[model samples]
Target chain A: MYDFSADIADCAQAVEAALDAYLVPDRLSGPGPAAIRIIDAMRHGSLKGGKRLRPLLVRQAAAVFGVAPGQALTAGLAVEAIHCYSLIHDDLPAMDDDDLRRGRPTVHKAFDEATAILAGDALLTHAFALLADPACHPDPSVRIGLVTELALGSGVGGMVGGQMRDIEGEAGGFSGNDIAIMQAMKTGALIRASVRMGALLGKADPEALAALTLYAEAAGRAFQLADDILDVVATPEAMGKATGKDAAMGKQTRVSQLGLDGARAELDATIAEAIAALTPFGPPAEALRATARFFATRQS
Target chain B: MYDFSADIADCAQAVEAALDAYLVPDRLSGPGPAAIRIIDAMRHGSLKGGKRLRPLLVRQAAAVFGVAPGQALTAGLAVEAIHCYSLIHDDLPAMDDDDLRRGRPTVHKAFDEATAILAGDALLTHAFALLADPACHPDPSVRIGLVTELALGSGVGGMVGGQMRDIEGEAGGFSGNDIAIMQAMKTGALIRASVRMGALLGKADPEALAALTLYAEAAGRAFQLADDILDVVATPEAMGKATGKDAAMGKQTRVSQLGLDGARAELDATIAEAIAALTPFGPPAEALRATARFFATRQS
Candidate 1:
């Protein structure tokens, strides 16, 4: 009965606007040409449309606790900027070496490798600045907490660490458990932060925080499993990037480990668990519950 | 009549210890082996000794306001970590491509290029986290201020932007004024943050803040000029790395722009200006004045 698609669209538009406001390429402020180049790369990498799933999750979670849409939107944009940066870096020649992202030339391919690297670095740093700004939260503690959570999710202990493992796995062998932990770090950590940040901004009690965290963890796993399934089952045209790149690279994805059927089964189970975790909030959490269900079935 | 050599050494030790505490490679927390590898690279890049000039400047600035040594040291370490991260990235093949740093293999040389990149990213992220932590400052506003200052100093419009220009300048030709602006961003921004963060933690008044800002700007420019002079004159044995790199690459530096004698004159003038800026602080700023003098003349 509850649909998140419209809400997702609205949040994505707001986040895009916020990102534009945050990233005006000021030639007078520093090195003119260089600043333009990096800012262009940043905009190129970030502004192209995607699912905007993370920001939507932030909004949906916030909506559950009556947090201001504007406040939730700021946190969402910060997290999205970080996500955009990670994608840019991940597409670098030394990294995944992908030339296309979101149906266009990747940051490195569009600009240059050095610019891409610097753009990624800038975006990551700017994310913290956004969180730290007074506009993000009234209470400094909440702002500090946002910064801390984002750093933990996106830094060495989370996304970067998982990226390292993922790269290593290309050579490779990894147990399912090892892969699971890597997925948790690489994808789940940020997703968890995206969901929980809205809750934190809303000043959710400890019990609600724990429950939402569990829900986010389940939803994150489901999302990854669905991604693995799509990598094998979907066409490159449908996905907007190369499909089966994971298989080509010998990546030990869930689909490879558990097979398509098992992976789908796992995704369904996780989605069910995610929905169950929202029982405390009951009807008010319908949007979040709908988001969890959608994650396991999202086509592109 | 005050010498700050002992004070510098004491501050350096404290900063090093704090860096170690902040960068513990906890395998159980994230992607274990990959985390260890990146942490190793981070430690390798950061732990090996240098002059600790930035942290020392922070401490000296804080001392003027009687800020607690521990609080100053924490802020100092955060700035130092950013410095270390910059060095690691600058030494990458896509950037400066230096093999040795401070007489040891650069991070990319010690580890792989990917690990070096990730390590730099981790350190940069961790720096903001350090600034945002309550341990860094009891006041959340001060912590947020540190985060904002650092983000501005190190992001696209600051150090990274400056580095972009520096990299582009390799094919060669930048005006004297252009080099000055670039140098301010490339090196001076973080240095300014170092001085300002200490004073900020100490809650310096607006007038004092302005004076220290001027002093830091002059000192930073002077320090870079000294480095340029050293690059031309100091032996690799003394400098702990290859000398004449700027000349060999046809890179424009203060020395290249102004000639050796002229560069030295500028350094002297900047040092004098730095000292004059501290006239308001009087004897409380003795160590800072000594530091500015040291910047103009320190050898490898």
Candidate 2:
């Protein structure tokens, strides 16, 4: 079995370092403190401790194709930055109104709302800049591929569109399919992008890419189902945020539409499907396989 | 002697077409209506008529290097999209608190604030996607250049940073230099990016690019100065948005710092310098020179 836990820790550390390196402007003539605060808030939102699953996914996917860890780390940072920005915006009073994230105050709670908003915007913008940097990839076409994929994953057609649907679902009217689609967009798109970007960076063969895409789709749904299940079963302290928010806000989720047992069954099937998608790659995809199993069983 | 008026109208129509072509997904399987509303809000904010001056600048600058209008237009739409998204976010109640934009209800007023925010986010994301698109430029490097330039121009280090300064400036006590820096970032960066993108798209020589850079800087300053002057002298009816916001908010502006006459003199001299930067290009820059002259004299 692949030591995914160690791999995740290593990937997280590298991504954090990459984020710090790229985010803190190396130029001596930086803007004043007021401007610096925005950067601070961005750092605060993005660098806060989390599972770093997205970047881990990127690195693992890249590993399957013999890509360098350092190069994969940079692309991973781009996806994580996008993910962090989305989290920041999602925590806004105009949205989820969450006060906590990852056992700390949400960005809006830690900083003021306006600063949080600006910080989120800045982070989102910086992700593209980071991907375009030569450090991310030698070939310009590779960089463009990463960027366009990310934009589709994070923009209106993907994450943002999913977010709007999420907000609309707060009134609790979504059917099972709608919930799946919303979850895919809001959370799954970036996760899917994470895997696909890594594969792209490694210049994976088309067949491998196709298999990975399938794996990502199944894995993404399993990840969301796991999250929904955690929301129902985990404690607020354990989860590092409010528990039962899905039920409280009447937000339709897999656990809500499907009973907890039903959701668990779906998660099992999805995880199985995710692993099956990787069957063509054999032992090289052990890390990714472990990841799907981890997501399905993860409590926090 | 170029009839810039006709050129401006032509540029606007062409950009509108490009934006429509790129933005409205021709695929019949578009997102559902709720997701479509977010797209609608984005289109509402971006597509509604304006001078399209930024795109016009991109087109004119591209013309300087014999770049195709279609390619330049794509890059121009990218910049215009960024500008529109900025305006939408700026008009939010948490930000500028304006209710009118282009003489129509702001996005937040027409749609809810959450929708407005998502729309702005989507638009910003889309701008990068447009630039990364192979259709924007044949060379991947050119697309990467455009993406990176647009990111820096629109992101925290540029426009967003400038906006923070703007918000901070509202409490008053800004030096003239501070105001200049803020304006350069807030409004000037994107304008400069527009000209630079067009030139880059056309593969202008380094010398020509350097000259255009100088011209862009001078013209950018002149553009902001003209805007400050308009804020003081123009009416809301004429300006389309609320006038005198700078003065009313106690925000520092060129006109506020320099007084009307001093600001006007600065504008005239800046316009002269902007035109002079194109001296190396001779009559080929007539359109650009006319643009500077127009900014100096336009009432709105």
Candidate 3:
């Protein structure tokens, strides 16, 4: 009976507005104005369009602890910036080489490759700076904790490390378990970080934090599994980026490891597990439960 | 009486030792092991060679306020990591496109572009994580301040902005003033940040901090001017990387705006101004004064 579309849409709108403010092309970090070209590329890379799934996850996870949407948006914005920056780098010629992202030209294509690279680097730096800003958390200690979580989630043993592993896998290939590790690091880490960061922002106690962490881990797997299924079934037009490109690259994914039907079955089980992890909070976690369901059936 | 060469050597040795400890290939940020390929690439890019000039700057500047080299070393490592990561990205084929760094093949050339990109990303992220560590500063507030300084210094309006401007300069051409701004943003920002971060770690009073900022700005310009001179005059063998690269690519620098002799005179004046900024601290700031002179005269 729960409708998540409206809630997700509202969260996305708020996140995008905050991101727009953060992406000011002329904002000064020094005496001279910021490079308009790089800032534009950052805006282009981040502001255009996407599901804003990560920010929504942050909001929903925080809502479970009675945190208001306004209170969680800063952390949401920080996580979203990291996501956008990663996509920009991933689409570069040296990496995934995709020209399209969110159905528009990637940063490198919209600007120059050099601008795109600088934009990615700046956005990555900006994410940490945003976390340090008092608006993210009044307490410096809590802000530092958020910084640590986001850095590790997207950094070497997490997203970037996963990408490296997947790249290595491209050469040496991946086993079934390798696929899981790769997926966890590449995507799951950031997703998990988004949820955990939200709980941290709410000052969730250890028991609540543990419950949320478990929920996040399961939900991360569900989201990734659903993505693999979508990759196999969705079209570029529907997904807003090159679909089937991963498969075309012979990238071994969970879908490749467990056949398509098997992956879909796993996704359903994963979402159910994700929902079950929230059982301790019952109706207080309905938003997250609804989010888990939405992940499986999303068209884009 | 101030023979800086030996002091410089000792600082470099200590920094390299700490960097070696920090650059472990298997340090985990998550459940999965870090990608060995990316970690190896990080070590290759960061550990192989260089002056460790930035860290030494950090040490000397911190020492002005009686901060021990040991107290400043963690910050030294963080700033150096930023410097190294920038070098890795700057050398990418889509950017400066050099195949060499520190007398060795550049990261992209050695490992592949993908690994180089990931290594740079991870290192940049790791920098913030390092700043938040207890060893960096016992006070979370000061650590947060460090993160903000480093981020802004290397971010959109600073180093990355400068690089983007330089790239744009490639297509549009640069005026004399434009070259100065580019130099300030590209190389100047991070150098300035290194000095200020050192001062912050030492808890310099506002008046002392202002003096250090002025000194840092002058030193940054002197260092950039010297680097411009070296690019024109130094050999690839001596510099340990591609020399004459900016010129060959028609990249504009201060040396381009002011001819070689003019730039040499400016460098001397700049170093003098740097020294003048430290007059308030007198003997306490002698190390920083020595550092300013060293910047103007370094061969590589």
Which candidate ranks first by lDDT, i.e. highest? Answer: 3
DockQ of each: 0.54, 0.52, 0.75
In model 1, how many backbone clashes occur? 0
Q: Write the per-residue lDDT of candidate 2 for residues B33-125, one digit (tens) a residue.
A: 127778778888988578898898888888887776676888998899889988888888878889999899999999888888888888888
Taking the tens digit of each residue's C-alpha lDDT, what string does model 3 give over A1-300? 556879888988998888888788544366356888888888999995887888888888888888888988988988999999999999999888989888889989988788888899999999988888898889999889888889889988899998888888898987658888888889889998999998888888989888888888888888899888889999889998888876888887788878999999999999989888898988878989988898888888
Candidate 2: the clashing residue pairs are: none
| Predictions in order: lDDT | 0.83, 0.83, 0.87
- List the RMSD of every prediction in angstroms: 2.0, 2.1, 1.6
Q: Pick the candidate with the highest TM-score.
A: 3
Q: Chain A TM-scores, all candidates?
A: 0.95, 0.95, 0.96
Which regions of candidate 3 deviate over 4 angstroms?
A1-3, A26-28, B1-3, B26-28
Q: What lDDT tens digits, residue by residue, belong to model 1 across residues B106-202?
A: 9989888888888888888888777876788899888888888888788877888888777666646786577887888888888888899888888
Please estimate how well model 2 matches the true structure, expressed as its whole-model Cα lDDT: 0.83
Local lDDT at A131 for model 3: 89
